[model samples]
Target chain A: MRDIVCEILSNKEVGENIFEMVLLADRVDDIQGGQFVNIQLPNKEMLLRRPFCLCDFDEVNKTFTICYAVVGEGTKVLSGLAVGQQLKATLPLGNGFLLSGKYNKIMLIGGGMGSAVLPAIARRNKDVECVCYLGFANKGKVVLEEKLREVCSKVVVATDDGSYGESGFVTNIAKADLDSLGVDAIFCCGPEVMYRAIKKTFADVNIPIFVSLEQRMGCGIGACLVCNCKIEREGKQGYYRVCKDGPVFELKEVVL
Target chain B: MQRRTSIRVERGGIVSNLKVNIAGVEFKNPIITASGTFGFGREFNNFYPLSDLGGICTKGLTLMPRDGNPAPRIAETKSGIINSVGLQNPGIEHYLATDDKWLAEQDTVVIANIAGASLDDYIAMGEKINESNAQMVELNISCPNVKAGGMAFGVLPASVEQVTRAVKNVCKKPVITKLSPNVSCIADNAKAAQNGGADGISLINTLSAMAVNYKTRKPILFNNNGGLSGACVKPVALKMVWDCYNAVDIPIIGLGGITSYTDVLEFMICGARAVQVGTYNFTEPMGASQIAKDLENYVKEQDMDINDLVGSLILNK
Candidate 1:
């Protein structure tokens, strides 16, 4: 595959350690939500793929956006990327979130940069009545609040430090909202801690829960073993490649 | 500009079928992405079409799930990286449930790399793999940082024999035991795997290495330790592959920082039946396919037959 350099539409800090990068890629087609784009870092020495959920897509504008955190050298370059700068990229990779029309009341939950993928999921199932719960460390780390509000029927923000919105884990807020509003399905993406917390609290929720996993990937494709996630079903257990099967998985299907 | 000379000058000629049949298994090409390098086959496919390459060796999976080591699990030194990912997989069960369908659809071969913290862990996971559609199972006994099993089992010949035997009991699939480089005798370890009934062997997983941060005066990786790989380790890996080649009769899959067809030829000349592409994947996104194409041209130019060069490298008397 030939690597093409696309112009950066904008790169700005949206929240704490979180950045939003808009790129002008006319060749991008059939891009999906869970699919990610790989960007070359400012430093060529660190040559590993940084996987980011496709945040939003624009066919008319021929632009796509990705939300990421400043976790490593790749993100450092991604954060510093300037408008109009050309970036080498491979776009719209991996199986995206599965969309089904069977469900109606939807709950979109995100913690930290996990919230990056929420809007795309919401956009995918716009016909459903959607509610969103977003968690962050504090107000400084909060992002996309207004944008999420535009898509969902209701939006709730939770911060651990109590700098903004409710002061507690977002899962707690989600539980309260779900009890009152009653959702048919729950979709979430966030850190391992938050995912675990949500998984445990929602154990009795009785809804089809979906979680987006975060793993360090090498090829961004299934060639490397670094991002293998284990799964067990019907008395059988085996390894699943996160880069392929999911960055988004049904909560019951995932081990953690 | 004049084209550079090709890497294959041997009897095998350029690998037209780049696709090869090893131990009754089929691979699209001889070039395979090593374990821990190409996550599951999906990540890289987003960059390049996987049909271009031969196979993929997934990251090491264990019996029970693991969170892996603390932060700073990776560090870069010169042309290589030292990583202590600590076998951070979601256990064997999680992998099969989620990714089985996607894997069965791929054109390339899929080999599952199994790691363990104990003998039971190895056997239990091996049993699970034997039931799946995985073409082969790579026993990763070479990781250095972990305390319970990893490098400890890899270094001692007796432990290697014991673990290999344990895994062999349940795993009916072709078992490829990945040997560690930090051991005193690479040949001895190769012999150990052969004695334990391993169908094949993979030489030189990763060398235990460390790097220091100048500013903080601490280790570069958060784990304070990691495995070294890349261009620098190819020579060492090739030498070990040659030594192991002479020591064992079974096939050997060679890996460690192979970015070019020349490196593939060196490993083949030294006695590797097949080769795995490692760190180069991080640098060149489509390195495996590029090497596959480059080697094909090299094979065509060499005009040598395949059998003549397959494990046919001669040593000075």
Candidate 2:
């Protein structure tokens, strides 16, 4: 990965607490859908860099977008970053989600802000048919629904209080459609609680579930062993560097 | 912004003296990546060449492979970070079998940072290191995460001497005892290492600290506590290095929160022959190498020998 100074093209809130930040910088020659970029906040009070998944990228304009929520001190600083400001960024980090085949239909599931990782999947595999399932707390919390619709073949948005597209959980709808959809693969990004729900709901279904993990990270490049994820690769069960070894893994392999 | 690739590259009748001799090992420069911060150098080599660094200390290696502590091992605070990774490493045998050959070819000095459960483990690993390609051995007896050895030996002066003498007796390469900052008397420990025949000494390791979550009223780190490092610790490190400089005759390799060329210079003026860049590497992908570059520029611009800066600080009486 290369470190370069990126100029903020735009920074605006897209959802209740979520924001979409666009940057103008050198063209990222190699960007996989699930890969991420680590942006350093220009403040001295916050020393660690903030990592974001690639929400959208334009190769021609050498621009990339990161969709973030003001969750902590760092992101609050990121949200306040004005247009035309410069920030140091290291791009195209982590092993992106490995699609099984080039030509295969896939099911993508996102929970709340996890929807930010969905559009990239469909963006990369344009040839493959992508049906998406998104779950949000309510209409106010929903994000990236339209962005997913622009890339995927179908988009099903669900809210807990029935304030949006459909009522109940999105997983239930995806589970019902799984039998007939005959999708070749499934990819998910969400909280551990949601992963538990998916694991219990899809245990009988035999499709390989791919997941992107989120962890507090350091070095973004994997030297510092702070961001560790447990997974059983081969027969050995061990902790892997989430920054280097993953951020993406086979659902069954992820110990958590 | 241009990088001077060699140690003594002369231009306009100016000889860039970025070279440093620590414990009889000649480093092309004074920039070494701190152990446990920079892994085997494979991941970072993708950004820059390994030869750009003057030295590398491998992740702390134990006799047997360790799974390390549970997740939430790190928490970032203001201007620094606290971590309790517990030295999760591939074991010394794995390194010698797999990573040793590759590290040897990196065209820079490799200092093996080894920790252990007991004195026997330290001596055994030291003896075993002779069979590898490492240029020096850095005894990591200051890790705060583990329960048995590490920090236990680093706190008191007598045990520090014993551990150093034990490793020095068996290890063929020069032995540098890495000191912990959490001790009550850092200079005494430096003198202890010197008394035990240590080739050199490096200080200070991360200080013991914690980060708490007020909402849950619990600790942020899974280990409850960890060692803190970053720019915040530089002042503490400089003072400790100066204290140790007055206490011992052995070469000093200073560390703790080193981020820039001036920080490197401060360590040298306080009597460090060389310095290691730690938490800053996590800040900048090319941090350690970049610091070496910035230092080279300053050295060339001044046309001065870097050695003259060692212990050059003047105090008001």
Candidate 3:
């Protein structure tokens, strides 16, 4: 990974409490779909860097987009940035999603701001028949639906309040379709509660499931050994670094 | 309106040497990456060459492979971070088989940092590391002794001396005792290491600190308390380094929240032969390299050898 100063080209609100920011950077080469960039906030008071997953990468323009939500003090500062502001970022970190599998029918599931990474996976596998399942709290919380539709073969939007596409949760809505859709692989990124629910729902189904996990980190790199997730190896459990070994792992490989 | 700026030129005659001798081992420079932060010198090597560093203290190793603590092992504070990593490593055999080869080939001193639960464990680990290619072995006494009911050996001067002397007896390489800041009298512990025939001393390891999530009325770290390191611990570390400097004659490697070139000089003036960069490495991958370069510039600008600055601080009498 390389540290470079990226100039903010645009920062705008895409949905409630969410934003899409485009940056002008010189090095955008070899950035994969599920990899993240750790952005150092301008405020000196906030010493730790904030990590955000890659939403899109424009190779020709040497620019990348990150979709973030204003959750805490760090993102609040990030959302307040204007165009032409420079952000020091360490990019292309973590082992991203493996898109080279032999699956023909891929099911991509995203919950809330986790939808930020789904577009890139869909774009990478444009030739494959990709079905996208996006969940939001309501109609106003939906984001990147149009972008996912651009690359995915089918996009299914679900909301808990039923103000948008379906009445129930995305996992509930997709449970019936997963059996009949002939899907060979599944990729999901969402809350821990959602992950547990999805794991229970798909435990009997024998498809290869991949998930992206989020954890509060000190150093986004592997040195600190703080962001650990338990994984099963040969019937024994071991801890793996979410920053290095993954931000992405197979469902069966990780304990949670 | 016209504006003019003045440029300064130099004769470029001064060639300042950054090499330092800690105990009997000589380092090319005085910037060693602290243990637990450098990760066997591979991860940061991707950003810059590891050979350029004076030394690298490998991540804390144990007799057996440890998976470390559970999730939520880290939490952020004012200007520091609290981590309960618990020294997760692949044990000694795995290190000698895999990481030792690469470490031996590097053009810098390699100090193996080892942790243990009992005196026998320390001695075993020390003997194993002594047979390896490492230049020195740092005994991390901050780890809790399971036999002693989880009381860290470094917290008491008697245990510190006992463990150090036990490991020093079998370890052929220079033994540097890494002291913890959790103790009340840090100087006594430094002297205890010296009394036990330690070649050098390195301090201060992270201070025991905690952070609470008020919303849940619970501690953030899984271990409830973790060692804190970063800019916030600099004053405490410098004072301890100074205390140890006056208390013992053995070479001292001072480290804690060291971030800049000035901090390097500060540690030197307080009588540290070398300084290790810790938490700052997370913020900037090449922070040590940059600080080393800047230190050379500072030495040239001051027209003095970097060695002359050691223990040169002026105090009010």
Give one digit per residue, the lDDT tens place, for model 3 in A1-256: 8888899999999999899999998877678878999998887666788989988887789999999999988899999999999988888899987666577888999999998988877666656678999999999999999989888888999999999998789998888798888888999999888889998888788888999988887678787777889989799999888889999998888886
Q: What are the TM-scores, per candidate, against the unseen true structure?
A: 0.67, 0.96, 0.96
Candidate 3: docking tier: medium
When 1 and 2 are scored with TM-score, the better candidate is 2
lDDT of model number 2: 0.89
lDDT of 2 by residue, A87-202 (tens): 99998899987563754899999988888888877887677889999999899889888888898888999998999989998888889988788798899988888888898999
TM-score of chain B taken alone, candidate 3: 0.94
Better of 1 and 2 by DockQ: 2
DockQ value for model 2: 0.73
- The stretch of ten residues in a row with the least summed lDDT in candidate 1 chain B is B1-10
User: What residue pairs clash in candidate 2, if any at all?
Assistant: none
DockQ of each two-chain model: 0.20, 0.73, 0.68
Error of 3 at A62 (Å): 1.4
Query: How good is the docking of model 1, as DockQ?
Result: 0.20
Instruction: Mark the 10 consecutive residues where model 1 chain A has the least summed lDDT.
Output: A218-227
Q: Which ten contiguous residues of candidate 3 chain B have the minimum total lDDT?
A: B1-10
Docking class of 1: incorrect
Over the stretch B188-238, how does candidate 1's per-residue lDDT look in tens digits? 999999999898999788898999977789997767877898888998998
